[model samples]
Target: MTKFIVKDIVDKFGYDVLAGKDGINRAVKIYGINRPGLELAGFDFEKNNINRRVILLSNKEQLFVNTLSEKVKKERYEYILNENIPMIILTEKFTDKILLEIAEKHSCPVVRASNITTSRLYQLVLEFFDEHFAPATEEHASLINVFGKGILLRGKSGIGKSEMTLELIKKNHLFVGDDRIIIKQRNNRLYGQSHEMLKNLIEVRGLGILDLSKIYGLQVLLDETKIDLVIELIHLDDEQYKSIDRLGIEYKYIKILDTKVPIITVPVTYGRNVSELVETAVSKLKLDEAGISCLKILQERFEEYSK
Candidate 1:
């Protein structure tokens, strides 16, 4: 399980830990952030729901808490201050001794948020957790930026994938990752990147590992990219080459996580310039995305003439 604990938040945001130091290691259950409202009124607060989330208390919650009767207020504080919550963040430096006392009594982590607006803090923390809790996987493929489109190249070993990558990089294209790509699915989209140790590194057959950043320049390297397309390279015989799709009407995809990325199957024959083919494939993808299809245009022209 992905363990995003209270200390993780403290480390990420540099928030001052005000109280409840003991509960720092409690993992944030992947539920999400919560702003206590009904719970603040000492009503309908579910332990299972609120206990797993990181609580954010801003100006509105504090003002609402001020209106509660002392009996209800004490009850509310004691009831919501359950054990093992990730942390309660007080935004805009809002602090209360009573709340801190309750939090300390139950050992719930409370952090004083930095000098950022509550909404911006919410956005920043939510984005962090959303990405941290996202589903991820690794692929035995190379990712490159071709014409601003992220294309993942996959095939058997020694099939000229690396050579094609090197060629593409030489044409001023950016190299995202080679040999292995770490992919994460966020908000129904797949993002591809290289492992930190393998960043800007590509291996070629008959040649040792090469750092493209040092060889070319750091500008040739990309930290990450949204996976826009996938290319499957295969060795094809004469009959297979003849069987290739002549029209650009056939649509294909490769599934990664829950997202389906558009895919192209290109046959790699001897002496064929795979780099140019990749560039052409991406160019065609760009045209297709813009609703400009050469085949569609030709079909319309032929139909008009026949009519």
Candidate 2:
């Protein structure tokens, strides 16, 4: 989990370290005072420990710092922090004395931002938090970005997921995470990205780590994807008898962060165009999003004709 502290924002935003220089690099924890709406959405508002959740403050809004006494500060800090909130974001250009005192007493890092508006600062903070504390999910597959949606493909080690991705590259899909996909939960949405080390490298059965750019050229490799869809490939079973959705009746869910992503199961049978079927599924998903469904539409038309 990546925690955000005021110091982290200052360093990233090029603000001068005012008071809590020591705490500047400390872990970020969520605080109760972040947003009222966030609390309603199931986030603990009062917890004060360094975790993935980051508490952002804006100095421009004019908080009542003068009315806050040392005793009051300590009491309020303890009161809200008991709820398990993370770091505190100070938007106001605060004095070094106040920052130092907060750091020493509460062990919470305070950050200062100059020249940037509160809204812009909030966006930067959110982005930082999202990247820092991405959730942990098992990575048995590779994810790529086709058009704009994130596509996750899974198969056995030797089932040619990477090879299929190579073919999709010819169809103009962008590259994303390969081998391992890192998912992060932000405000409840799941975002996926590729690992830094294994990115753009695929392992074949006989060959070791092969650079995708060298083999398939620069166009074949991608940096990251969001994981909008999950595709699972399995060996064909006759007697085993698998039940697939002929009417798209079944839906599969893959939990990335706090959200569940749509999944499609594709059986890898001989003499079938697996890659093309996956592509068709992708297109079909898009159409489904637009309030269109071939099966449903056909059924409706038939009912109307019968009427």
Candidate 3:
């Protein structure tokens, strides 16, 4: 389970602290945001799951609270604050004295964002929560995005993974990460990124460490990408290579988190253009995805001829 603190939100979003400064250490468990508009309209607000969420009061909600009678306003505000929500956010400079007072009394953090509108604030907050709460793991591999398709290269150390990645970058493909790849799972899709310290950097045997962004320009570096294909490089003898499947009809998959990504095995041999071969493999994968599998088409024709 992932946990985000009120202070994390404040630091990330640059929200102003209006009240409950001491409660900034509170934990936010839910990834959803609540508007509290229905609650201010005399509706019986659901408090069961309110404590886990960040409640927001936009301009329209603040206006609705202002129009209510003093007794009703106090009652509603008291009911909401007593629920001990993780935090409350006010958008577009909205500030209500009573709401702030009640939040302070209950020790619930209240924050204000002056620049963004209500809808935009909601969108931003939800996006942040989605990323912060997603499941993540790390891998020892090189990740690159070729023609908008993410390709992961895995092999033993000193097996030319980084060298091949550099070649692909020279061919104008985007470099995601080298040596270490941080993968996060969201909505059953795995997204890969490099560690902050290693971003835009790759280590080659003779060249040592090279900053790709500086050498190949900014277009050569990619911040992150989905893991679409996993290619494992193997150093096999000529006979061993000949023994492997040649039809390319066998389906192989590698599981990352809960998603299964197609895997291709490439032999690393002397005089072999591994970089171009990997590029061709990616093209074939894309064509297969588009229902144009060459192997499948040939198999269909062979079956028809046999009949």
The global Cα lDDT (0 to 1) of model 3 is: 0.85
**Where does candidate 2 stray beyond 4 Å?**
1-8, 29-63, 66-110, 216-220, 238-241, 254-258, 300-307
**What are the lDDT scores of the predictions, listed in order?**
0.85, 0.64, 0.85
lDDT per residue as tens, model 3, 1-307: 3467999999998989999887999988777887777677756446665455788887778778778887898888887775458899988656678888878888889999987877888888887887888888889999999888999999888789999998998899999999989998877898999987899999999989999888888978889999989998888853546656778876588888878888878899889999999889989988988889898788899999999
* True-vs-predicted CA distance for residue 36, candidate 3, Å: 5.6
Report residue 102 deviation for candidate 1 (angstroms).
2.5
Candidate 2 per-residue C-alpha lDDT over 116-217 given as tens digits, one digit per residue, 9 for 90 to 100:
777777777677655665556657777777767778898777677876776677688876756877776666766666777777776665777777777768
| Residue 298 local lDDT, model 1 | 94
Off by over 4 Å in 3: 1-3, 7-17, 21-29, 35-51, 58-76, 79-84, 91-96, 112-121, 237-244, 300-307
Error of 1 at 2 (Å): 6.0
lDDT winner between candidates 2 and 3: 3
- TM per candidate comes to 0.88, 0.73, 0.79
Clashes of each: 0, 24, 0
On TM-score, who's better, 1 or 2?
A: 1
Ranking by TM-score: 1, 3, 2
